[model samples]
Target: MSNHRQAKDPRLQKISSQLAAHGLILRGGFVFGDGEAALEPSEARPAKSVLLVGQAGAAPWPYFLGWREQQPRDLQNPLDTWSREVIDMVAAHFSAWTVYPSDKPYQPFQQWAMRAEGLKPSPLGILMHPEYGLWHAYRGALLFADEIPIPDIHDPIHLCDQCVGKPCLKSCPVDAYSGDGFAYQSCLAHVRGTDGEPCRAGGCLDRNACPYGTGYRYPADVQAFHMASYAGL
Candidate 1:
């Protein structure tokens, strides 16, 4: 007897369910046709697929801290390990895979999924998990053989609606995040400046003020690393 499984296998559903149980959310979409065009001058192609982004929830924070803090000297190792595990799992469910930072210029795979299926950005970002406050990130993504079914993209709920203090836009010592948009250069200057302030010593003041994801927040060092990376330091 021979094992017979369809190429577009239903087993993917089981795998996805398992991932969800582990706090990883699966998002599907097509590979952007202009992958090379989206690359930055200093950045290399990170992967070669449409992308399936996975993010673990706040429930994983304790586990995340175990690797993120205790092994501070080897931070990248654990992050890389977890990210690759997600990539591999997604790849198994899809035809191809690619992993990149969500902050990258490349269109979000969720947006791509919508466009491919004739959709729009609605009001909110995709996968409207109520707690992450747009702070959660896409750790890795995978590309697939066919389009996957996703909830009709809805408008993102403006977190500002519920935030009484709106601290994220106000906590910045330099007011980097305006109600309208970010003052990227100003933020970078403040973080890297010789002000010798608590923001520099701790992490992004604006990000820390986000009321959501209080439990899932990135460790301070991780926040600093990301802020420094954004500052091009």
Candidate 2:
């Protein structure tokens, strides 16, 4: 599509509205570089731009839960399945290509998120948003054949740097999080033990200890769902 036609297209606005109804937001997008490996497996042509879509906080929990109740009870990775279904529907409406973080080829979602939103990782490895803290996530993205207008991003203050005492690093019982990096085995073991009940039922203690974006923190049930998923329960 021509730039002129893209400028006149109302798809972006419509897409935002439709996604919002399902508790998803267009996190922002970027023009793809030539020869980037972000095309449909069957197609030789690469999409020109990609719009990141995801949820910011517990906004999607209710919608996702409602959707999940209707699906087969034995389904694995229910959340990922629901996300793909929702995002795929929206992508189809606008004739855009759909990609997920869970796709076999493993799209570079983390790098794309940093580039698209000017975000940086906190000590805990979750990208710290100035406003959302650790409560948001990128579910999928929509790719378009033509370059479209994306919002101009300005670098925001990294919240982790400004935190007074860094309560997050100190909150974990096993000290799984630190300046050095995460101790995955330690965290997993702790979460599986009887003493890990608090973390297992309420989500990561380190993540919840963050002061920023408290209002957006996921609810206990939502947190439990994620913790169960993380624990392979």
The best candidate by lDDT is 2
**Candidate 2 lDDT (Cα, 0 to 1):** 0.88
**56-174, model 2: which lDDT tens digit per residue?**
99999889989989999999999999999999999889878788998878889999999889999988889999989999999999988877877567898899999989999889999
Cα lDDT tens digits for candidate 1, 1-233: 11223254464576577566546665543333443434322334333334355563444444455645655563544655666665675566544545455435654555554443333321222233345544455556554444343333344454555668766666777776664566767777777788725665566776677667677676666665555555645
What's the TM-score of each model vs. the native? 0.59, 0.93
In model 1, which regions exceed 4 Å deviation? 1-12, 17-24, 27-51, 57-89, 99-105, 108-129, 151-157
In model 2, pairs of residues that clash are none
Misplaced by over 4 Å in model 2 are: 1-9, 34-40
The deviation in Å at residue 23 for candidate 2 is 0.7
Which candidate tops TM-score? 2
**Ten residues in sequence with the least summed lDDT for candidate 2:** 1-10
lDDT of 1 at 92: 62
